[model samples]
Target: MRTSRTELLLGRTLLVVALVLTVLPLLSMLSAALQPADRNPTGLSWPSDPQWINFVTAFQVGHVWQLMGSSALIVLGVVPASLLFATLAGYALGGLRVRGGRAVLVFLVLGLTIPFEALIIPLYYQAQAMGTLNTQWAIVFPLIGLFMPFSVFWMRAHFVNVPVELSEAARVDGASIWQEFRRIQLPLATPALSALAILLFLWTWNQFLLPVVLVANPLDRTVAGALTFFQGQYYSSIPLLNAGALIIITPAIVVFLIFQRQFIKALLQGAVKG
Candidate 1:
């Protein structure tokens, strides 16, 4: 009983520490954003006037709405494409029988080993050649491709946990393969799908490097890319930059918060079942 109490205390302490670690930077950024322009470059300090207008300025002058729109386009396109392709491919690789199944699975796994940085140059030239460069599709296509290997691997693991009897029963009932997958397997795979959707949304939203190389104009840049415009070679508008950063990060935070319970439940379901 004494040892259990001590363990509980330790766990609480650890949780508090983790919370502090996670929140410190966020608090600092907010503090900085609120600080007056005159107070910015003198290191960190409490806000004197607490200018709330910086957010508005960031949104308007900083081209935040355009960035948000671009980011949204990428996320909307990439998320569905990634999930559909990943789930279908994963289902095939995990549950269905096909010639070269193992070989195809191996090839997909090999994709996970190759880092994105290595392919950026080739991808850039290819996008340019294909006339997709500077377009939202350039960023969307590459992100979908980059995220697929991991999504497939994860969804495959989830699909493996589903009982084969379900598919077999559907088959016996004269259901076609498409009907079986669409009606039975896809419904059962919702938790994994939700989890994957949240993850893919976040990944695509936060993407900077790909957008940097693929897009040259601010009109086509993502929120992540737009944050870079706040800095100069010598000086940066720290307050405005922090405000922009906050604006950029807010959607993702709200997304996770709104779906947090679902996200956790899905994670638990995937872990236990898979």
Candidate 2:
């Protein structure tokens, strides 16, 4: 089947429009960030004298290094723990026989439907009870649990498409269940795990509400949450604020750029599995 010329033209036009819509704001923000800090930069127009020092000012004023460290800590805690648990659960559910696995899966799928907003109150109080409030663990622990449903779903989607023959062949070679999972499946799961890691990192990095509500100290907040605080503190400094905002989101952008191929492959690999 071939697309008609009119359809092709229309599709190209739509894509161009989408690209502009996406890129225009980023360009506008970059322009704002480059403007002189003292001179309030208005709109997307390039400044007369581009002040690259706005980033330096924002970095210092925003305490961006500290924010980066805090966000990194959360990402390290959440991604590894969540991935380990989700991989194990996903493997058992998707690739192995478990008693009442269907019921368990249904429960996890139900968890996906429950919004975080609904759970925040209880989590806050629970953290307070545990004496972890105002600490990084407040964010770290909840995020891991909060991420479980989708992470498990993602891993299971990958694992379910894995052929049973691989497991059977491994079993015939005197491989135990743990041996098959560790030796055979995990090696084959690299792309999917990479994709999951990227997503987990992004989510854990960008988490705002949980940290804001649970942690009182600004130093303990994730970059995204700290950006909000920084916005309030520097509301008068438009260029600096924009610069800080850009800096806050840079890690996620870089991660996506580096792993984009593997990420796309993981998502699409199961689309037409043999």
Candidate 3:
């Protein structure tokens, strides 16, 4: 039953290669970001006189703080609401096994097959019709709807694996379904919920197209979405552009690092799922 040493060695080698591939680009970016503003960074070579102040300049020019605030507002609107509704839907379909749940799940799963690119045109017109175009709410509302299928599927994956006996026991004890979900299954779903929150946060944060299309004012868009405008505005300065990009992505990296344990725990928990 033990893993062979040769298999272990090959696995470790693959992981090392993957890590190197990931880190190299980030190192290249950092090296480029440290070079003097208005100077062409030829490649990934470290600058002899690194200009760390370029970050400060990029921040001011890019309005990094304001972009961050705008992105934060959109994320706050989307993730929590998505989580709540998806969890409820997942519970009903996966745990409660309510009538017609499979039909509902099938309908939701169909959403997973439809590309966001395909939906953008209709969504733009819908936003315009609803008079939410050029506002963050335009992006916010669509993202929540767009995120629902995957979010429900993710939560359902966790819930479907819950022991049915627990639900039966709760019912026999005269526990209402609400009480059972809130006090029992919900507590046990922490890992799934934590992982889902992180994923939704990352996706919503890096979401570029929706914000770009839905919100006309670049400053009103998410940071990632506004990078196009940022690039145009900072066209003369490669270093400053890289610095601005790094500044924008750093928060996502930090959040992932901080909660990586929960993320991994959820993965491990789901590994044996049906």
The full ranking of all candidates by TM-score, starting with the best, is: 3, 2, 1
Global CA lDDT computed for model 1: 0.84
lDDT of 3 at 219: 84
Q: Candidate 1: worst 10 consecutive residues by lDDT?
A: 228-237
Candidate 3 structure quality by residue, lDDT tens digits, 77-178: 999999999999999889988899889889988999998899999999999999999999998999999999999998888899899889999999999999
| Colliding residue pairs in candidate 1 | none
lDDT for each candidate structure: 0.84, 0.89, 0.89
Better of 1 and 2 by TM-score: 2
Alpha-carbon TM-score of each model against the true structure:
0.90, 0.93, 0.95
The most accurate candidate by lDDT is 3
Candidate 1 ranges beyond 4 A from true positions: 1-9, 41-45, 232-235, 270-274
Query: Per-residue lDDT of 1-274 in model 1, one digit per residue for the tens?
Result: 2569889999999999999998888888888888764455445566767889878877776677888888898888999999999989988988785678789878889999998899999999999999999888899988888998899988888888788889889999999989999999899888788888999999998898988888888768778876776656313568788888898899999999988876787778745543
Ranking by lDDT: 3, 2, 1
